[model samples]
Target: MSTFEQKILSTIETNQLMGSDQSAVIAVSGGPDSICLLHALCNLYDKLTATCVYIDHHLRPDESALEAKVVETHCLKRSIGFMSITVDVPAEAEATGDSIEACARRLRYNALEQVRSDVGADIIAVGHTADDQVEELLLRLIRGSGLKGLSGMGFKRGRVIRPLLEISRQEVLAYLDTHGHEFCHDSSNESVRFLRNRIRLELLPVLEQRFNPAIRSTILNTVNILKQEEEFISAESDRFYRSLVRECTNEKDPAGHHSISFATESLTTIPAALRRRLFERACWETGCRPDFQHIDTIDKLLAKPVSGTELHLPDGVRVVRQHDSLLFTKLTEDQGPRESVAYTIEIGQEIEGSGSYVIPVLNRQLDIWLSDSDPRDAQLMRIDRDTITFPILLRSTAPGDRFTPLGGPGSKKVARFLGDRKIPHHLRHLHPVLESDAAIICVLGLEIDERCRITETTTQQLHIRWVKP
Candidate 1:
């Protein structure tokens, strides 16, 4: 066996990248690293079920075809199963603002995944060398990365594994040279337009020439240390999220919004380190990864008086303090108080004025109109027409109001009801209320006035239903 094949055998065994009988596909890009991976995998084809997939991202139309042909010829010489897939990337990538490198990489990986599934391959192999790892570390360090970013690419990300990370690019090139197989080179790699190209071609060589030649080793060390710190940070973050959150039920919407509040005492109780972790993970979980600026904003919010103060975060996200708990929500600028349309809903007609609006009145009888008839019998109530105050105003909940509340008694103030239920700050403004400019009428799906209950001597009955668009 050649030196490349011998090296692959050792690394594969060490990493448990592939068992003797297991199936794997090598992702060959016709580049030096992948070309070496293809050859090494082919050398062990007798022991392992190995195939090759070449993704032709149609950047250079003629060039891709030529490369695919070369890969096919190489595989044919070895009697290996070879699959080549073509994908258009340049136009689409430019439209999406992704650099050519990034778009091609994403497209190639996706194609390889589909091919892997089709071929019943358990693992997909990539040829990422120690040189690539070092480059990534320097690149990430330059970009102002945190622990996650500083940690260079893992050997395995999802189903793709890089067993050759321990190998050097020179070692792979040496093997290809010995075997008399020249790999396809991309001309775009010479361009200085992208930062990565300059880093890989110019900065790395100069550093290796003048500075510590063992920079790659320390780069690898940095990644390993960062990974260790990352694990501890993630664990502490999970603890913080668990420790600081409590749930409150919203009665306005049965499929109610969840209100997550961080108790000031609980937050203050956590160490400063844990506080940072808590905020970081909290932002990530809520789909808004708070940057340094956002973290500063959060810190400012924490310093605020613990009343009902709120802050609108970037990306339509909001952070608010209600009493003792901090809440995060996705909300927008109030669209100038929910465009109201009061057309005096008539009976026996569907009024699609503003959402599911319909008021059907009968001579002491019943008329119902709702989006779903899936029996909210328990949530439904009757009202006496004479007892109900007229000029019923339909609007979102306001402060200092009281309603009997569905499935409850003795009338709870609107603010108290929302607070006890933990209605999310965003939804609180959107929750519909029905009030008669007097006492609040049944807060739509919440409750009906005791005086409005249908009794023995009811003359007229108005059936009102709440709905959505």
Candidate 2:
């Protein structure tokens, strides 16, 4: 085996990047780093199955096709599987308002993940060298990144492994030359419009020549130390997270939202650093990508003496400070607060004798049927047929909407009832309440009105269930 291939094998074994019987989808970009990785992994086909995937960013249409062909030719010669995929990075960037670089990276990883899943591969191997790691660390540092960002990329993250991460770009070129392999040079890499290219082509050379002669090795050493420290801090953060955090499954809260809650007192007891990490963890659990500003804003929220203060965050996530707990909720796009429209169901018309009536606007369905036996499930409300009036109205709560909850002493306003149950303020108006000609029948998924409750003397029972998606 060549020295370069031996280095890669050592790195793979040391990190346990892949199992002996597992297969990998190698992302070959037709560059020296990727080309070298592809050849190296293919040479080890005796131990593991390998497939090559070329992701075309569609930035340079003419060059992309040629790059794919080069990767395909190499795979063909090695008798390995090859797949080509094209992604419209420009269109996605325009749609998402993300920069070209960010969009391309996102779409490229997504495409690679899709290929990995399609091929049933155990892992996706990418050729991110030590040089790339140093460049990434410098870029993130210039952008004012924290400790985790300074750590650079991991050797193995999820199902993606970087086998050549310990190898430098110069070493990659040496390996390619030794094997007499040709690779494509992306012209975009020379363009300074992207910050990364500038760092690699301009900043690093100056830093190496004028400042430190071994700048790359120095940065790599710093990143390695940071990664180890980050792992330890992350472990501690996880310990606190598991002990303090709890998923909120409150039935009164609106559906189609993810929520997690932790006691505010517990947050105060932990150090500020761990508290920030916990905040990030909570936001991640609710599908939010929170930055430093978001975490700082949440920290400010923690200092407030009052409860019920909420701040909107990216990806429809909202952090609300309740009386004793902090609630992080990610609302669905369609679940935003809106004026609820009234939906009506006439006893024998819209909702026939025994059938389900869907409310498309609310994304809910009402299943009503006649039952001789009483409903034991709290979700299924068994009402006395004689108490209900015709043409039931399903509408949001109004000023005068009041109902005596089952086994309650007196009538309570729907708004106050929802507030008492800890329903979010934005979702209060969206809570569905069934109203008959005379009074409010029930608050769906919560409690039925006392007057409509089935009694022992009642012979006929009508069971109504509200289903949410």
Candidate 3:
């Protein structure tokens, strides 16, 4: 059997990588590794039904087009379905601030997955090889990574598969050349500026030449051994997490924010390793994830177990130890508070829009002939033409999140005021807070804009009302 044929068949049987009954999409970049991968899959096309996807990142427009044409021609000559997608490279690279290598990798994978889903392919194959695996292992060590990072990439990730990961780049090139197929050369692959590039060009070569000739084989062998250890550790971590965490909600309200209950004793009982996992999961659940150091600090604090101690972590993630368990929240730097939300009445315009200012016409002012007498006697705040702040702040409400009263002429915390007024607990979270600079204007219908009370200069009026829906 040919060398490539043996490798392909072995990978399929050993890894349970592919089944003849299924279809796949190969992400071919017109490079040797990808071309060899596509070529190998083509041998099984009759049984497996595969297509080729070429992602044309518009970096070097001419080069990209040429590469796409190469892949298209190859696929077409073999009667395999081929497609090319173009994405703006420079804009995306700049937006993400990724190095050329990083940007290209991100765009390439995203485009490939999109194409995979679009084509209804059960598997998507990539072209990583043994040399790439060793380089990655070295890179992960130098960058200070945990066990998960050190474990390297999986042979199968979600719907994506790496068929050539066990082979070397030289073997792939030899296979392609032996079959008389040409492939594009990626110039950036030779650069040594990036750390991975440095490892690939500098360290890997020296290790092979001077000390260990089987470094690539050794790396693969270690990964093969660790795969089972990694899987076992993962299952233990998950089991501990599931047994401890329980979600509680008092019926999800408008904002979709709900209450959850947990035990500190239960959380602390988990092994230290499992505690870290729980902390990370908790942060993600609360729309944030505390950084590594913050997680470590929270884990340490869990030992002594105190309540109400808040730790502000990177990225605005805050954790509060309440009783035994911890609660995660978004932190806000103390800034000058908004004074008030105010607006003037337009002659006959709707006051409803995205702004802090309220210019609602009172129910008393509307003609029974022109408007229905709203059952709720919620009086709309009126103002003169001079009082409105253009483009005011209209936004969602907060917990322990409050507003200042307009007619009452004082600031009241939202939670306390709502509870005192007996506003339905479910409806309070949906209440919109209108603000200008320092104080709250109106709790929509529950209160009025303080600085914008009906004044002597008020000239125009219309009927306006707030409804809970």
lDDT of each: 0.65, 0.79, 0.64
Candidate 1: Cα lDDT at 326: 70
**Once model 2 is optimally superposed onto the true structure by TM-score, how far is the C-alpha of residue 122 displaced, in angstroms?**
0.7
lDDT of model 2 at position 235: 95
Give per-residue CA lDDT, model 2, range 61-160, as digits (tens): 8799999999999988888899999899999875655678988999999999998898899999999999999999999999888889999999999999
Where does candidate 2 stray beyond 4 Å?
246-252, 331-469
State how far residue 281 of model 2 sits from its true place (Å).
Answer: 1.0
* Collision count for each candidate, in order: 4, 0, 15
Candidates 1 and 3, the one with greater TM-score: 3
Tens-digit lDDT string for candidate 3 (191-276): 77689989988998898999899988988788766767778777887787666644422233334443243577787566777778
| Model 1 clash number | 4
TM-score of every model versus the real structure: 0.62, 0.70, 0.65
Candidate 1 lands at a TM-score of 0.62
Error of 2 at 460 (Å): 44
| Highest-lDDT candidate | 2
lDDT-superior candidate, 1 or 2 = 2
